[model samples]
Target: MLSTESGEVNCITMFKSCLRYPFHLKVLWLVILLGCDSNLPHTNEEDQKGQTALVPQHKFAGTKTCVSCHTKEYQDWQGSHHDKAMQVADSRTILADFDSAKFLSNGVLSIFYQKDNKYFVQTTGRDGQPHEYQIIYTFGIHPLQQYIVAFPKGAYQCLQTAWDTEKKKWFDLQPDLDIAPNEWLHWTGNAMKWNTACADCHSTDLRKNFDVGSETYHTTFEEINVGCESCHGPADKHVTFYETNAKGTPPPLYMHNNMRPKELVQKCARCHSRRAQTTSFFDYKGHFLDHYDPSLIITPTYEPDGQILDEDYVYGSFVQSKMYQNGITCRDCHNVHSLKLKKTGNALCLNCHEPGYNTPSHHFHKINTEASQCINCHMTGKLYMGNDFRRDHSFRVPRPDQSVEYGTPNACNGCHKDKTPNWAADVIVSHFGETREDHFSDHLLAGYHENLERLHELISNKTYPEIARATAMYYYASRISPAEVKKIEKFLNDPDVLVKNETIRAFSQLGLGNYLPQIKPLLEDPVRLIRLSALEYVNKYEPNTQRTSIYQAAEQEYMTFMDMSADHTSGQQRKAQYLEAKGDVTGAIRAYRKAIEIDNHYNQARMNLALLLYKEGNTSEAEALYLKVIEQEPHVSYPHYMLGLLYHETGKNEKAIEYLRQACSRTPAILRAHYNYALILQQNKQYDKSIKAINEALLTFVDNEELLYIRLVAELNSKQLQEAYNTCLLLVELAPANPNYQQTLQEIKRNLESN
Candidate 1:
């Protein structure tokens, strides 16, 4: 998703990664986090086999409808988090002190006051000036409460300044963030806008009717707060069934008492998961994948070893749990209506676990202490949204051993902050045997670190979570070796829908050449997500004016998917890509322009737009855009690298060298930057500098073939016959299959022998 000419690059890297899975794979239970890796499986096929259904068209009876017949459930839901999810700001509902209270952060002072019984905050507005704004609604009931303010163009913004309920003090969420008025992360920016980010989850039956052309939001919701119908399907039919008092009415065909574990999880994941929305509005139909592309166990969101690094909501982590695999739903531990834990402490864990597990012999800790608590170790906690202490749902045994090598967070080091991971690892080994048995986290780490052997094995292994294997494939698919790429064609028919979807997505980047014939079968994929992923590749490579019914259907789904997220900057970028795929350059350009209009700071949009303009020979504007991105993000190397390429193509050798040198200097080594920079230097007869650049790059990255080739050519041109001969030997020995390298080696040997 969110593809570029290169690959899926985020303009502003936010929730694009936003899930955490566990280290434990099976006892040995790794819950396959249902994200689009880099966002798993058929061990999972039972619940997912035929789950896709049309969105359930039902009339909303509302929360009031259930109050009469379901008094007990109504009472339980009342005063719960769902009921108080959102509320109109008033004396009773408002938690923040609006009595001319003052709070300052990042050199800006915000004042809150009640003017004529209406809540108002004097803070830095969209224009980055101090302004008083009327508060429309109060969001959330727990650790922190954020106020919603109506802005122009029908957009409602969630203010960054929030009341920390526990501390009973006003606090700004982005305390150190000093953004410009037009910046996306600014208070009035689209990021903090309620209509896009908060509305869908806080309210029931939200319809984010965004006008992409107008750049406006006509967002609507069934109820102000998450209501009964939010979790249960629309209850109008249930109400009708009860009101008629008729026998053989068939109970209106909704989720009843015997709800499957997966079904219940999906109901919660509608709002709980960190994912990409596939639909404009959510309805009780299709699988979780059909509605949303969940974030996989990827870096920046989750740790490399699959620990929570961001707000995962819950679904991503929960699914990776043994509890979920054992068919345990949220209701098993939590009261469905009240949203409270069914039992407290060890009693809750003891419901399923053995009594022996509760003893000191098992926990190896003193009784009746924080260390003795099962959740303290197994369910490690992290602070999110400032003060909300949420625990990772991927229940796992502490693995300080993995942490020792990988630098991943472990439960042991979480509490034993003074001790090193190695010390913790040693303690763990002593307590629970040195041989911790094989876990998927080991393979996951191995694949992440570019252990291709481990990655190749993981791609086909079914015992590990399918999502983890798919993530391995995500990394493995970028292989320079033809043999590795060929190995992946078989996985195009991976029984797991997640694996199959990702396999096609990878080839979509690789283009539709040899894999095109094998991909035809996936057009008839059982899952809509997979079919759509298949269509993306086919449409990009095999462009057609006349299409088959399957192609047309998949295209329609892709269009809807794009339109659903049209308001988002990422969506606009995707729209631009979609148009470009279909040979609509003008439309693609316009979409990119619109994306920039939405958020001026979107780097990828500018980077891609510049590319299209460069191709169209609009060099002046393209050059200006690249410069603007450089000015905005001085640290990012890709823009510099692209600019360098552009300059070299235009025959501006000096400017090209300057940008390429800057690119090489930036962090997270850009391999091509070094190659191009060194080649340009050698081309300009700066042999010593070229040789030095290659050596410097080699220090950071493993000896790459292209860099070595560039060096070999540079050495030969410089009349360093012995150096040329030596480099050619390494280059040919490293990759004997390359005829160019082989021929060059033969020429170098002859030149060296003659010299």
Candidate 2:
């Protein structure tokens, strides 16, 4: 073998010679490129096939101790992507051309170079000045690689500028978005900080150990990167069992080899998911929701038809798949040890699917073509970080109809860029017959359009997948009427935890405080997720002295969950909410402040703090905060609406109307902004504008009583008798029992008849 320096030089020379290929190949077969480590000991036949036939004499042994017995597994994992997921920057691991490589981005020149064998970059630092900083570590490998720069308080920020390994080019990961120097989205800001955002997923058994007092991180980890212990859990007890009984066959204990497939999926999901880690310590067991709060299939994150829209990773999509519903798991297709597909390409999928599925007849594509591939149609790939294309794991059928109706992308359109969605839909109809198969997307799309009947069916359907039903419930919960809320109460005891959890949330959203008795039972729920949610609702009730003991227990659990995740900005915000619920205004303010301190650009916390300040009669401070938020995040509509409310409260009607109009224009989807703007317009005798604004609001939130009332007032004031009559009829239809709507409808009818 050549010297270390010579080998690196040769590798660089080879890279220069090779043709630039698509990154998918390198991303898919990562293990093949990263050769096996020879240092791992060979496993004997006895250790290979059977469980370790020993009981531990001592306590937890590290991966090194297992190497002698389970050598094959250890060797397979040593050079895998997980093994190199994170590493200290060195000559051996660093992939970037750090030898005086220069890249100019948006007028800023960044220079990468090495001095005294230490990787360094001269780039725009936190203070917006050109500064030389040492690259502490290399994060991830293959398609692209990013350097981690260490900051004070044990914080590491992943630089936005990454080296595209496959293409051999330096590019900004977030190219389209230009981040200002002091902006939170900046590479040097809180958004890119590795300790809170990434370390837990990248390393094994990581504890953020964030000091709330000093606002510093004393992060610790059991292992540097994902290792044998990461998936297998703390193997001390298992190691003890093996060491003690070396001669006899032992049953699995800590390995969890006998765990249900769903349990195994949860174990993998802890890292694979685009989820919030609710607790610092994930037990590597139970449902993903029990440990981490998975992002729902919602707007901005997912398409209306539940297609992946953001860097949602996989779990959020996978949970909605037929495969997951049918007990298919990550291990079924992938080798747990090597983190590789058991079979290459179509063969892997074909193992479970019928032989007919692989043929042109089923796929309606020519043989040996890209269209013939199952993934190209079913699991459409989305390019992320410019080059790394990740296929959606939902494994859904091509729904060109949804694309035509909801403006969602279909796999057909994704591949056939030249063809319209209508053409794709027609082709699909011709091939597969006009009768489209019933899909969860239909209900999801219906929910998106505020179709109450379809949403109710989706939420109440026990046969549907829990994730799908839960997502439907979330959308339906948003605009539930008082009458519908009664029917929704029955789902609070849903068999599926997700369904029950969402139902409880929907109950809270309806503001139906009378339903507390129904929600009370869930405080003692088996699932921590449900119990915590119950605590949030139950704590809102006043002086429950009879149930004080159990309330304290539930509150303690909720508090513990929040404290475990206090390092997260959301966690701090939740704590603030909890404090506010308990009437501790000062504590809530401090928690909100801490959350803001942790993440300066956390708009929700700022909004919540401003609202709290406003409630406490600190009008000037609240107004200042709202203006500051508007200045920072101009696109956000909430601050504008809040400022509008603030000005209105201070009797500045003109300014209020101006801000409210801005809010309505910025966020057309927000029902309150439109309603408030229309209400103010009606008061100002601008009936035509008020009617127009109310119509816009009605499109998003149909049959809203307050909005309907405002619209009726606008129509009456403008002398639009027929429109006023129609509006009054809708109000009466929506709330049949309400005498106010009944009286208004009769009066409007009288006026219309006279006209």
lDDT of each: 0.74, 0.73
Which window of ten consecutive residues has the lowest lDDT sum in model 1? 33-42
TM agreement with the true structure for every prediction: 0.86, 0.86
Clashes of 1: 11
Candidate 1 lDDT over 1-755, as tens digits, reads 10112311221121111100111111001111000101011011112223553224456777888888789999999988889888888999999889899998888889999888899999887777899999888888788888888887788888888899889999877766687778777778777777777777887767776786787777777777878877776777678877888678444333567678887787788788877777777766666777777777676667787777777888877876767878998888999899999999999999999998888888888987889889999999888767779999888788998887788899999999999999999998787888887666788787676566787887788777766777777666553344446778878878877788778876665443467677765666767688667776676667673587766766777777788788777788788877887899999899999888878887677877887787788989989998998997788776787788778878898998999999999843556677778877876889899999999988755567767777776777778888887888898788888787778778777766786
Model 2 ranges with Cα > 4 A deviation = 1-60, 246-255, 284-287, 481-484, 510-512, 542-549, 632-636, 703-706, 716-723, 729-755
- Report the number of clashing residue pairs per model: 11, 12
**Candidate 2 global Cα RMSD:** 13.1
Model 2 lDDT on a 0 to 1 scale: 0.73
Model 2 clash tally, residue pairs: 12
- The residue-by-residue lDDT of candidate 2 on 1-755, one tens digit each, is 10112112121112211111111010110010111121232222111111123322222246687798889989988878788887778999899999899998876789999999899999998888999889887877878888888788777788888999998989987778777787666878666778767777777666665666676776766667777776776677666667787666553543466777676777677788776665545544345565676667776677778888777778878888989989998888887887888998688898999989999789988987888888898899778877888889999999998888889999999889999999999999998998987888898798778777788888888877787888888877765655667768788878988889888777666555687788887777767688778887776554243556666666766766787667566778788877887789999999999877766767677777887887788989888888988987777666787788678767899998999888887742455667778877766889899888878777777777778887777777777889888888888888899887787778777767786
Quick one: best lDDT, which candidate?
1
